[model samples]
Target: MEDGDLLSRALDFYGLPKKFDANLVRSRFRELSRKYHPDSGEYETDILFKELVQLRDVLLSSLQNDPFAILENSKEDPEGFQFYKSAKQKAAQAIEKYFQFTDGNPVYLKKEDNPALLRLRQELETAKNGLEEFLEKFPKSIWKEDTETTLKKISVWFKD
Candidate 1:
Protein backbone atom coordinates (compact mmCIF):
# COMPACT_ATOMS: atom_id res chain seq x y z
CA MET A 1 0.00 0.00 0.00
CA GLU A 2 1.01 3.63 -0.50
CA ASP A 3 2.33 5.73 2.36
CA GLY A 4 -0.86 7.74 2.46
CA ASP A 5 -2.89 4.58 2.39
CA LEU A 6 -0.93 3.16 5.28
CA LEU A 7 -1.57 6.25 7.32
CA SER A 8 -5.23 6.26 6.45
CA ARG A 9 -5.58 2.57 7.23
CA ALA A 10 -3.87 3.08 10.54
CA LEU A 11 -6.29 5.82 11.44
CA ASP A 12 -9.22 3.69 10.42
CA PHE A 13 -7.89 0.62 12.18
CA TYR A 14 -7.54 2.53 15.43
CA GLY A 15 -11.00 4.06 14.94
CA LEU A 16 -9.43 7.50 15.17
CA PRO A 17 -11.01 10.53 13.60
CA LYS A 18 -9.25 12.33 10.77
CA LYS A 19 -8.35 15.20 13.09
CA PHE A 20 -6.70 13.72 16.16
CA ASP A 21 -3.70 14.42 18.36
CA ALA A 22 -0.77 12.18 19.24
CA ASN A 23 -2.17 11.44 22.68
CA LEU A 24 -5.45 10.31 21.21
CA VAL A 25 -3.77 8.04 18.73
CA ARG A 26 -1.63 6.56 21.48
CA SER A 27 -4.56 6.07 23.80
CA ARG A 28 -6.61 4.34 21.16
CA PHE A 29 -3.70 2.16 20.15
CA ARG A 30 -3.15 1.08 23.76
CA GLU A 31 -6.79 0.22 24.26
CA LEU A 32 -6.96 -1.79 21.07
CA SER A 33 -3.65 -3.45 21.83
CA ARG A 34 -5.01 -4.82 25.04
CA LYS A 35 -7.86 -6.42 23.18
CA TYR A 36 -5.80 -7.86 20.33
CA HIS A 37 -2.58 -8.67 22.13
CA PRO A 38 -1.70 -12.31 21.75
CA ASP A 39 -1.13 -12.77 25.46
CA SER A 40 -4.37 -11.01 26.35
CA GLY A 41 -6.37 -14.20 25.53
CA GLU A 42 -8.95 -11.90 24.01
CA TYR A 43 -7.59 -12.85 20.60
CA GLU A 44 -6.38 -16.34 19.77
CA THR A 45 -3.73 -15.19 17.27
CA ASP A 46 -1.07 -12.46 17.08
CA ILE A 47 -1.71 -11.41 13.49
CA LEU A 48 -3.98 -8.51 14.30
CA PHE A 49 -1.76 -7.42 17.15
CA LYS A 50 1.30 -7.34 14.92
CA GLU A 51 -0.53 -5.25 12.37
CA LEU A 52 -1.56 -2.85 15.06
CA VAL A 53 2.04 -2.36 16.10
CA GLN A 54 3.07 -1.47 12.56
CA LEU A 55 0.17 0.93 12.16
CA ARG A 56 0.91 2.61 15.45
CA ASP A 57 4.54 3.09 14.42
CA VAL A 58 3.50 4.63 11.12
CA LEU A 59 1.14 7.11 12.79
CA LEU A 60 3.61 8.04 15.49
CA SER A 61 6.40 8.59 13.00
CA SER A 62 4.18 10.78 10.87
CA LEU A 63 3.24 12.87 13.91
CA GLN A 64 6.86 13.16 14.95
CA ASN A 65 7.88 14.86 11.70
CA ASP A 66 4.67 16.66 10.91
CA PRO A 67 2.16 17.22 13.63
CA PHE A 68 -0.18 19.36 11.54
CA ALA A 69 -0.33 16.87 8.71
CA ILE A 70 -3.73 15.30 8.19
CA LEU A 71 -5.30 13.20 5.47
CA GLU A 72 -6.86 16.30 4.05
CA ASN A 73 -7.51 17.32 0.47
CA SER A 74 -5.08 20.23 0.58
CA LYS A 75 -1.51 19.51 -0.39
CA GLU A 76 1.44 20.41 1.77
CA ASP A 77 4.75 21.98 0.76
CA PRO A 78 6.86 18.84 0.36
CA GLU A 79 10.17 20.61 -0.12
CA GLY A 80 9.71 22.80 2.94
CA PHE A 81 8.42 19.88 4.95
CA GLN A 82 11.44 17.74 4.07
CA PHE A 83 13.85 20.52 5.00
CA TYR A 84 12.14 21.16 8.31
CA LYS A 85 12.06 17.46 9.08
CA SER A 86 15.78 17.07 8.40
CA ALA A 87 16.62 20.07 10.55
CA LYS A 88 14.38 18.82 13.33
CA GLN A 89 16.04 15.41 13.27
CA LYS A 90 19.46 16.99 13.50
CA ALA A 91 18.46 19.10 16.48
CA ALA A 92 16.85 16.12 18.24
CA GLN A 93 19.92 13.96 17.67
CA ALA A 94 22.20 16.70 19.00
CA ILE A 95 20.12 17.03 22.13
CA GLU A 96 20.16 13.27 22.67
CA LYS A 97 23.92 13.13 22.23
CA TYR A 98 24.47 15.93 24.72
CA PHE A 99 22.20 14.33 27.26
CA GLN A 100 23.86 10.94 26.84
CA PHE A 101 27.27 12.43 27.64
CA THR A 102 26.04 14.72 30.38
CA ASP A 103 24.00 12.02 32.12
CA GLY A 104 20.88 14.16 31.51
CA ASN A 105 22.13 16.93 33.81
CA PRO A 106 23.05 19.96 31.73
CA VAL A 107 24.78 21.71 34.65
CA TYR A 108 27.87 19.65 33.93
CA LEU A 109 27.93 21.06 30.41
CA LYS A 110 28.77 24.48 31.79
CA LYS A 111 31.51 23.24 34.09
CA GLU A 112 33.23 20.71 31.85
CA ASP A 113 34.66 20.88 28.37
CA ASN A 114 35.30 17.58 26.65
CA PRO A 115 35.90 16.76 22.98
CA ALA A 116 32.69 14.77 22.70
CA LEU A 117 30.59 17.46 24.32
CA LEU A 118 32.29 20.11 22.23
CA ARG A 119 31.46 18.22 19.05
CA LEU A 120 27.89 17.75 20.17
CA ARG A 121 27.66 21.46 20.93
CA GLN A 122 28.94 22.31 17.46
CA GLU A 123 26.38 19.96 15.89
CA LEU A 124 23.63 21.63 17.91
CA GLU A 125 24.85 25.06 16.79
CA THR A 126 24.66 23.94 13.20
CA ALA A 127 21.13 22.60 13.69
CA LYS A 128 20.13 25.87 15.36
CA ASN A 129 21.55 27.87 12.45
CA GLY A 130 19.79 25.62 9.97
CA LEU A 131 16.46 26.16 11.70
CA GLU A 132 16.98 29.95 11.58
CA GLU A 133 17.67 29.70 7.87
CA PHE A 134 14.56 27.53 7.42
CA LEU A 135 12.42 30.32 8.92
CA GLU A 136 13.76 32.68 6.26
CA LYS A 137 13.46 30.24 3.37
CA PHE A 138 9.98 29.02 4.17
CA PRO A 139 8.53 32.22 5.51
CA LYS A 140 4.99 31.06 4.82
CA SER A 141 5.46 27.46 5.94
CA ILE A 142 2.96 25.93 8.35
CA TRP A 143 5.93 24.75 10.41
CA LYS A 144 7.23 28.28 11.01
CA GLU A 145 5.87 28.54 14.53
CA ASP A 146 7.14 25.11 15.49
CA THR A 147 10.60 25.82 14.08
CA GLU A 148 10.79 29.12 15.95
CA THR A 149 9.69 27.43 19.16
CA THR A 150 12.38 24.78 18.76
CA LEU A 151 15.00 27.46 18.16
CA LYS A 152 13.93 29.28 21.30
CA LYS A 153 14.24 26.11 23.37
CA ILE A 154 17.68 25.40 21.92
CA SER A 155 18.75 28.97 22.69
CA VAL A 156 17.93 28.44 26.35
CA TRP A 157 20.64 25.81 26.57
CA PHE A 158 23.27 27.81 24.67
CA LYS A 159 22.84 31.29 26.07
CA ASP A 160 26.16 32.95 26.72
Candidate 2:
Protein backbone atom coordinates (compact mmCIF):
# COMPACT_ATOMS: atom_id res chain seq x y z
CA MET A 1 0.00 0.00 0.00
CA GLU A 2 1.06 3.59 -0.53
CA ASP A 3 2.32 5.52 2.54
CA GLY A 4 -0.75 7.76 2.56
CA ASP A 5 -3.03 4.77 2.22
CA LEU A 6 -1.30 3.06 5.12
CA LEU A 7 -1.70 6.14 7.25
CA SER A 8 -5.33 6.43 6.33
CA ARG A 9 -5.89 2.80 7.12
CA ALA A 10 -4.19 3.24 10.45
CA LEU A 11 -6.36 6.20 11.31
CA ASP A 12 -9.45 4.29 10.26
CA PHE A 13 -8.48 1.41 12.52
CA TYR A 14 -8.64 3.80 15.47
CA GLY A 15 -11.67 5.70 14.15
CA LEU A 16 -9.77 8.94 13.80
CA PRO A 17 -9.45 11.53 11.08
CA LYS A 18 -6.24 12.35 9.21
CA LYS A 19 -5.56 15.07 11.74
CA PHE A 20 -4.40 14.03 15.16
CA ASP A 21 -6.83 13.68 18.09
CA ALA A 22 -5.05 12.60 21.25
CA ASN A 23 -8.12 11.84 23.33
CA LEU A 24 -9.88 9.67 20.79
CA VAL A 25 -6.67 7.91 19.89
CA ARG A 26 -5.86 7.12 23.49
CA SER A 27 -9.37 6.01 24.30
CA ARG A 28 -9.49 3.70 21.28
CA PHE A 29 -6.04 2.40 22.09
CA ARG A 30 -7.13 1.53 25.58
CA GLU A 31 -10.12 -0.40 24.30
CA LEU A 32 -8.13 -2.31 21.70
CA SER A 33 -5.21 -2.89 24.01
CA ARG A 34 -7.48 -4.49 26.56
CA LYS A 35 -8.76 -6.87 23.96
CA TYR A 36 -5.42 -7.69 22.31
CA HIS A 37 -3.06 -7.59 25.23
CA PRO A 38 -0.92 -10.69 25.62
CA ASP A 39 -2.72 -11.62 28.80
CA SER A 40 -6.16 -10.95 27.32
CA GLY A 41 -6.05 -14.46 25.75
CA GLU A 42 -7.12 -13.03 22.40
CA TYR A 43 -3.81 -11.79 21.15
CA GLU A 44 -3.38 -11.54 17.42
CA THR A 45 -0.04 -11.51 15.65
CA ASP A 46 -1.41 -10.22 12.38
CA ILE A 47 -0.85 -7.09 10.30
CA LEU A 48 -3.83 -5.46 12.01
CA PHE A 49 -2.06 -5.52 15.36
CA LYS A 50 1.09 -4.11 13.80
CA GLU A 51 -0.87 -1.31 12.20
CA LEU A 52 -2.52 -0.49 15.51
CA VAL A 53 0.86 -0.14 17.19
CA GLN A 54 2.24 2.03 14.38
CA LEU A 55 -0.72 4.37 14.45
CA ARG A 56 -0.56 4.65 18.21
CA ASP A 57 3.14 5.45 18.10
CA VAL A 58 2.76 8.09 15.41
CA LEU A 59 -0.10 9.77 17.26
CA LEU A 60 1.73 9.66 20.57
CA SER A 61 4.85 11.17 19.02
CA SER A 62 2.82 13.94 17.51
CA LEU A 63 1.19 14.59 20.86
CA GLN A 64 4.54 14.82 22.61
CA ASN A 65 6.12 17.09 20.02
CA ASP A 66 3.22 19.24 18.88
CA PRO A 67 0.24 18.82 21.12
CA PHE A 68 -1.36 21.98 19.77
CA ALA A 69 -2.21 20.13 16.57
CA ILE A 70 -5.12 18.56 18.37
CA LEU A 71 -6.51 21.98 19.17
CA GLU A 72 -6.25 22.97 15.53
CA ASN A 73 -8.26 19.92 14.56
CA SER A 74 -10.93 20.82 17.12
CA LYS A 75 -11.94 23.66 14.85
CA GLU A 76 -13.56 21.10 12.59
CA ASP A 77 -15.95 20.20 15.40
CA PRO A 78 -16.63 23.51 17.06
CA GLU A 79 -19.78 22.54 18.88
CA GLY A 80 -18.29 19.53 20.54
CA PHE A 81 -15.09 21.44 21.24
CA GLN A 82 -17.00 24.26 22.84
CA PHE A 83 -18.87 21.87 25.09
CA TYR A 84 -15.62 20.23 26.12
CA LYS A 85 -14.04 23.58 26.91
CA SER A 86 -17.03 24.74 28.92
CA ALA A 87 -17.29 21.51 30.86
CA LYS A 88 -13.57 21.59 31.65
CA GLN A 89 -13.82 25.13 32.94
CA LYS A 90 -16.73 24.22 35.16
CA ALA A 91 -14.85 21.25 36.54
CA ALA A 92 -11.86 23.44 37.28
CA GLN A 93 -14.02 25.86 39.20
CA ALA A 94 -15.50 23.05 41.28
CA ILE A 95 -12.05 21.71 42.04
CA GLU A 96 -10.97 25.12 43.26
CA LYS A 97 -13.94 25.24 45.58
CA TYR A 98 -13.04 21.83 46.90
CA PHE A 99 -9.54 23.00 47.69
CA GLN A 100 -10.87 26.09 49.39
CA PHE A 101 -13.16 24.01 51.56
CA THR A 102 -10.31 21.79 52.68
CA ASP A 103 -8.02 24.79 53.31
CA GLY A 104 -5.42 23.25 51.00
CA ASN A 105 -4.87 20.52 53.54
CA PRO A 106 -5.34 16.86 52.84
CA VAL A 107 -8.27 15.34 54.65
CA TYR A 108 -6.38 12.21 55.60
CA LEU A 109 -9.16 10.88 57.74
CA LYS A 110 -12.64 10.65 56.41
CA LYS A 111 -14.76 13.03 58.38
CA GLU A 112 -18.38 12.71 59.28
CA ASP A 113 -20.91 13.75 56.67
CA ASN A 114 -21.52 17.19 58.00
CA PRO A 115 -23.75 19.63 56.13
CA ALA A 116 -20.84 21.68 54.81
CA LEU A 117 -18.89 18.64 53.70
CA LEU A 118 -22.00 17.22 52.08
CA ARG A 119 -22.56 20.43 50.15
CA LEU A 120 -18.97 20.49 48.99
CA ARG A 121 -19.20 16.90 47.93
CA GLN A 122 -22.27 17.69 45.89
CA GLU A 123 -20.50 20.49 44.06
CA LEU A 124 -17.55 18.27 43.28
CA GLU A 125 -19.84 15.54 42.07
CA THR A 126 -21.59 17.99 39.79
CA ALA A 127 -18.31 19.08 38.27
CA LYS A 128 -17.15 15.51 37.80
CA ASN A 129 -20.44 14.59 36.21
CA GLY A 130 -20.15 17.48 33.82
CA LEU A 131 -16.70 16.42 32.77
CA GLU A 132 -17.89 12.87 32.36
CA GLU A 133 -20.70 14.07 30.17
CA PHE A 134 -18.25 15.98 28.00
CA LEU A 135 -16.17 12.86 27.60
CA GLU A 136 -19.21 10.93 26.48
CA LYS A 137 -20.18 13.61 24.02
CA PHE A 138 -16.72 14.30 22.65
CA PRO A 139 -14.53 11.32 23.11
CA LYS A 140 -12.00 12.95 20.80
CA SER A 141 -11.84 16.26 22.64
CA ILE A 142 -8.46 17.96 22.72
CA TRP A 143 -9.07 18.73 26.39
CA LYS A 144 -9.43 15.06 27.25
CA GLU A 145 -6.12 14.82 29.11
CA ASP A 146 -6.88 17.90 31.13
CA THR A 147 -10.32 16.57 31.96
CA GLU A 148 -8.92 13.23 33.03
CA THR A 149 -6.29 14.91 35.19
CA THR A 150 -8.90 17.04 36.89
CA LEU A 151 -11.04 13.99 37.49
CA LYS A 152 -8.09 12.21 39.11
CA LYS A 153 -7.50 15.17 41.41
CA ILE A 154 -11.16 15.16 42.34
CA SER A 155 -10.95 11.46 43.09
CA VAL A 156 -7.95 12.02 45.36
CA TRP A 157 -9.75 14.79 47.21
CA PHE A 158 -12.78 12.58 47.73
CA LYS A 159 -10.59 9.97 49.35
CA ASP A 160 -9.88 12.50 52.05
TM-scores of all models?
0.49, 0.41
Clash count for candidate 2 is 0
lDDT digits (tens) for residues 40-137 of candidate 1: 84999999999999999988887654443442222344447766766788789887877787685535344254446567768778678778877877
Candidate 1: regions farther than 4 A off: 70-90, 94-160
Highest lDDT: which candidate? 1
Ten residues in sequence with the least summed lDDT for candidate 1: 67-76
Which lDDT tens digits does candidate 2 get at residues 84-103?
Answer: 56455555666676668778
* Cα TM-score of candidate 2: 0.41
Instruction: Name the 10 consecutive residues with the lowest summed lDDT in model 2.
Output: 64-73
Clash pairs (backbone) in predicted model 2? none
